[model samples]
Target: MRESEYAESRADFVHQLRIAIKEANETQYWLELLHQADYINKKVLNQLIKTVLKS
Candidate 1:
C-alpha cells in the first residue's frame, strides 16, 4: 500500500491503489469471517476493520 505513495506515474499509482483496495477488501472479509466464528473478540475486530478501511 505504501508503494502507491511513491508511484512514478499515474498509471502505476492507480494500479497500486487498486491492488491495495482489493487486498483490504479481502482482509475485511476474512476478519468478518473470523469474528463471526468467534475466533476474535468484537473490540479487536472493530479495531482491525477501522484500520483496514482507514484509507
Candidate 2:
C-alpha cells in the first residue's frame, strides 16, 4: 500500500478509537451518577423511617 493511504487509514482508526473512548467515559459517568442517586434515595428513606418511628 501507498504511504498516504496508510496514513489516512491510521488517522481514521485513531479517530474511531477517540470516539469509542469518549462514549465509554460518558457511559461510566452516567453509571456513577445512577449509583450516587440510588445511595441518596436509600439515605432519604432511612431518614424518613427514623422520623416516623420517633413520632
Candidate 3:
C-alpha cells in the first residue's frame, strides 16, 4: 500500500493499484482454500474475509 505513496507518475500509481488488487484476490483465494480444507474456523474465516474485503 505504501508503494503507491511515492509513485512518481500516474502510470506507477495505476500499476501499484493493479498489483494490490491482484494480491488481495490471491489472499481471498487462499483464505477460502483454508476454510474449505477445515484448517480455519468459521469465526476466524469470517473475520479475515471481512477484513480483506473491507480493505
Candidate 4:
C-alpha cells in the first residue's frame, strides 16, 4: 500500500480505538450505578466486573 494509504488506515484505527474506549468507560459507569442502586446482584456484578477487566 502507499504511504498515504497506510497513514489513513492508522488514523481510522486510532479513531475506532478511541470510540471503543469511550463506550467501555460509559458501560462501566452504568454498571457501577446499577450495582449501587441494587439493580444487579452481587454475583452477576462480580461476573461482569471480571469480564470487563479481562477485556
TM-score per prediction, in order, is 0.85, 0.55, 0.86, 0.69
**Whole-model Cα lDDT of every candidate shown, in order:** 0.96, 0.55, 0.90, 0.72
Sort every candidate by lDDT, greatest first. Answer: 1, 3, 4, 2
Candidate 1, superposed: residue stretches over 4 Å from native: none
lDDT (Cα, 0-100) at 45 in candidate 4: 82
RMSD of each: 1.3, 16.7, 1.2, 6.2
Lowest lDDT 10-mer window, candidate 1? 46-55
Better of 2 and 3 by TM-score: 3
**Model 3: residue 6 alpha-carbon error in angstroms:** 0.9
Q: For model 1, state the Cα shift of residue 43 in Å.
A: 1.9
Model 3: lDDT of residue 55? 79
For residues 5-41, what per-residue lDDT tens digits would candidate 4 score against the true structure? 3445778767766766676677778888899999998
lDDT of candidate 4?
Answer: 0.72
Tens digits of per-residue lDDT for model 1, 1-55: 8999999999999999999999999999999999999999999999999999995
Per-residue error for 25 in candidate 1, Å, reads: 0.5
Give the per-residue lDDT digits (tens) of candidate 3, residues 1-55.
Answer: 6798889999999999889889889998999899999999889889998998787
Pairs clashing in candidate 3? Answer: none
TM-score of 2: 0.55
Q: List the residue pairs that clash in candidate 1.
A: none
